[model samples]
Target chain A: MGAPEPLPARFAPGARVQVRRADPPGHVRTPWYCRGHAGVIERICGSFANPEELAYNRDGLPAQPLYRVRFSCRELWQDYAGNAGDAVEIEIFQHWLEPA
Target chain B: MRSHHDMGGRPAGKCEPSEHEYELWEKRVDALMMLLSDKERQLLKVDELRRNIESLGADAYDRMGYYERWMHSICQTLIQRGVISIDELGRKMAELEARDGRA
Candidate 1:
């Protein structure tokens, strides 16, 4: 089968976004911690086949745009006692992000 | 449902990281993973490996070492792809065990 048409990159760098909180079965690269958290787009990391579909041995065509999202440590953990300025970055697929 | 493999940010004891040289079998498993996932072969995708590893219940995940999990996933992937059958694998393993017993 041929590669699926690529999805367009919607959010630009520095755009405010939130990770989707929905949980579905099968393989998901989006970690549970980041779900429902708000973050800013750090940078664009190009597009790749969706790992969710790839796990099933399917041709994960229509590659999705990937972005490095930056979230403050406090935003991730409610009881975080570390430096308030501390932040964590994660590479997230476009499908998992929505405008904040 | 939260999978056992998703252990990010969970409260846990302090991590005492250590390193050790890979054993022969571990090396073989790593090499096998690379060769199978290589572009030309493409018999296995890293996603498949992760899926299988995640499917392994929490108990097995905790008990098995890193490469042991990878080895299990590799065999499962090959079987899922019909590249080899369970009966064939069982027979081969039994044959090797018999030979070792004789030795």
Candidate 2:
């Protein structure tokens, strides 16, 4: 069967959120550059099975909400030598985010 | 800790983009991926393939090309899932090597 329906969203569009900095062993999709950084939710990209669990051949039930979070370039890079308005958008899962 | 594959924003040299025609084996690997991950089969997942690639260690990761890594991961994942046995793979490789006469 196809993936289950997306889980209900927790944070709405434009909500502030931060990526959790935890680094557990095993497969993960969250990039290291975006962790522990604050950003605004650009949009919800629907939910899907957790990649970490899927990597281990397990059924990732209760799919987590996914979001395209927009972060300032300066926030992600200390010396971003670019425009102040420059930003990067990354797809993050609900389990990796916390209200900021 | 950051995995070796997660190199975003890290210090790096200029990125020189280039493209070339994919070799036959590369295309075959792509087809294998599509077939293995097809809905009816469900023998492998894209996530599992990526996890295996990431776990290939820094040395092999840098040494192998993109499709090379994918092929390696496909074999590794199939073995991990008990879809293929190591002895079967070894025998096949040996047979091919003997037929090819170490070329």
Candidate 3:
């Protein structure tokens, strides 16, 4: 079984948050593209077991809240040639986000 | 180690259209991987499976197709977890190949 109970979600939908810039050497779920990128929480995906610990065969204690953060492509890619209206989205853990 | 599977934005390649059908072994591999993750089996979590697939070296990672990656990862995972011994797996594989040879 996972954490006795799912951790209460910290961020809510439409909340502005920034992805923490980090280069963890171990197994990480945060995608490098979205690192240090500011985005809005599109939605709070259901909490899931912490993959970081699970990768090492450790018991992923309390589950972590996951959020679907959406970002504009132009901001994510310095020279993104796609349409100006294009955007990118990725699921990030609560631990990786800080108030912008 | 930071694996190549994290292709997030570091890329400059055009996406290729799939023009071929799934070979029989590929389809079977897909189904078998799903079964391993079943609640009853619990041999591997989907995330662990992903990590295993990403852990492959650059050569095997690029040389193999999508399902081939899954097959490779699944085999390694089962073996690492000690759920299925190598000898048992080899015997089953040989049986399967012999059946195919006769067909």
Candidate 4:
């Protein structure tokens, strides 16, 4: 069989997106706290890792690009300090994000 | 030292009408106590779990991605057991978000 299809690269820096939580027994980069939450793409970190590669014993899963997403502290927390302008940056796999 | 007329203000009915009624009340109290104890135990367990998870450090945390997957499985299990409705699951998810300051 031909090599496995490369995972799709979806977003770029400055793009708005939402993270999705993929449930069940599989590797995923998205965290539960940020799942379904809207955030802005901060930086597109180059691809070198894929959770599926490690979770399942399949190194064939092509390397997928990762991204650094920034979400406002208030967006993620109820009691976040309003004046600090805090944000959370997480390295999420491309598949976790979609256009927002 | 009181006359029978002085008992007028007291409840005149039987303390327990039937053995069945007594048993039902006993069961109700037992259920309530069990629920309270369970709530306390779960709270402590959750706190400990959170601490253990957080103590893993940043690199180790990234390496271990099963916690969320496990939590999702827990939610599904609760739903299947009828302990929580779908709406309650959503609410619990929202609570998690709020805890992380995402909500």
Candidate 3 chain B, poorest ten consecutive residues by summed lDDT? B1-10
Residue A27 accuracy (lDDT) in model 1:
91
Q: What is candidate 4's lDDT per residue for A1-100, written digit by digit as tens? A: 8656666668878999988754533334356667778899999887754654533223525777789999887887767767667888988888778898
Docking class of 4: incorrect
lDDT of 4 by residue, B1-103 (tens): 2222123224456677544334554555444434522745332122222333444445655564444423433444345446679997689889988998953
Q: Chain B TM-score for each model?
A: 0.95, 0.95, 0.80, 0.30
* DockQ of structure 2: 0.83
Q: Provide DockQ values for all models, in the order shown.
A: 0.90, 0.83, 0.52, 0.01
Q: Pick the candidate with the highest lDDT.
A: 1
Docking class of 1: high
Which regions of candidate 3 fall more than 4 Å away from where they truly are? A1-3, A57-59, A81-83, B90-103
- Each model's TM-score, in the order given? 0.97, 0.95, 0.86, 0.44
Q: Which candidate tops TM-score?
A: 1
The window of 10 residues in a row where model 1 chain B has the poorest summed lDDT is B10-19
Residue A79 CA error for candidate 1 (Å)? 1.7
Give the winner by lDDT: 1 or 3. 1
Q: Where does model 1 exceed 4 Å of error?
A: none
Error of 3 at B66 (Å): 1.4
lDDT against true structure, model 4: 0.59
| DockQ rank order | 1, 2, 3, 4
Order of candidate numbers by TM-score, starting with the best: 1, 2, 3, 4
